[model samples]
Target: MAKLNINVRSFSYKKGIPTDPTGNGGGFVFDCRGILNPGRKEEFKTQTGRDEAVIKYLETETKIALFLEGVFQVIDISIEDYIQRGFENLEINFGCTGGQHRSVYSADTTAKYIENKFPEVQVTVQHVVQEEKNWINEAY
Candidate 1:
């Protein structure tokens, strides 16, 4: 079985965090609302975090890089520990006010990080709010 590194999700605080469909329980839930929101600006209102403009805004204008650095450190421990213990499945969630910008960026970035850093484990991302709208997920 493929051991899950994280169940990263971008969620709205109003809607609450998403449950793990991975069937295994317990993981990190990072709140991205504390980061500066680009959604407040009219230019970025319609853009999701995946967009280059919003990505640049988050990386340059906000503390998201620092926040994610700390996140990677903490998650690295769990990944290492899980491997040591012979475990499968871990959970991780990222939440913001709308789940469109900060949370989505964080979740996607973290998944990519794990895929590159670990290379053996599986990484999954769920954009809770965006998926409800226009995003269609593909095999990762």
Candidate 2:
């Protein structure tokens, strides 16, 4: 089974390719800046995407759902090919102006979706600026 490393980063903190321990230059980077930003609202200014309010706002008021649908379509293909090819590592990154909100939510959602869909694959999600990481299948 292949393992997927989904990284979420802040554009303000880092640019260019993410550090790949696999050393194979394998990954995809998606920019979330084009999506509606929840940070622009005063009520959500202090909130991260992990918060229920922010998640609800993003899900209801923005195009994030559609955007992620497209993201999953592309990533699903890549994941399948990687598993078939016996490749062990695949990385996908989501970046926004700050790693706190949109990027974090997207990364977490993507990781969970991958874990549910492909239980045979290992999945790890990391939020760069937040310093948070989750190993989805580790407890299973």
Candidate 3:
């Protein structure tokens, strides 16, 4: 049998709950509201987390690093067990007020981390609020 590791979905709370694209429910949800919000600033008001400026602000000026560490620790345990059990579906949603800034960043960060750490897993990331609607799927 082919090994299927993980599937992740990132979305805004405004868009409603993110369901597994493959039809599974009961995934993890992380709220990014606790982190320092960059959206309050005038310059960052129009920007999303994918932008360089927003990235810098979240990484350097906020507690996002530590926040993500805790997120990873919790998710890692679940992911490891999922892989062992031959589970093929997992959904992770990051939610913020606007789903444009903090939530988007958290989703992207988490997806990238899983992709890098567990090459056996397939990772999918979606930014629901962006005009272009970014989607990334990485499989190995």
Each prediction's total of clashing residue pairs, residues at least 3 apart in sequence or on different chains, is: 0, 0, 0
All candidates: TM-score? 0.91, 0.84, 0.86
Best by lDDT: 1
Q: Per-residue lDDT tens digits of candidate 1, residues 54-79?
A: 99999999999999999999999999
Q: Which ranges in model 2 have alpha carbons more than 4 Å from their true place?
A: 1-17, 132-140
**In candidate 3, what are the lDDT values of residues 2-119, reduced to their tens digit?**
5664655555677777666677777798889898888788788777888899999999999999999999999999888888888888888888877778888888889999988888
Lowest-sum lDDT 10-residue window in model 3: 131-140
Tell me the spans in candidate 1 whose CA falls farther than 4 Å from its real position: 136-140
TM-score-wise, the better of 2 and 3 is: 3
TM-score leader: 1
lDDT of 1: 0.85
lDDT: the better of candidates 1 and 2: 1
Model 1 TM-score is 0.91
Off by over 4 Å in 3: 131-140
The TM-score, computed over Cα atoms with residue i paired to residue i, of candidate 3 is: 0.86
Better of 2 and 3 by lDDT: 3
Error of 3 at 114 (Å): 0.5
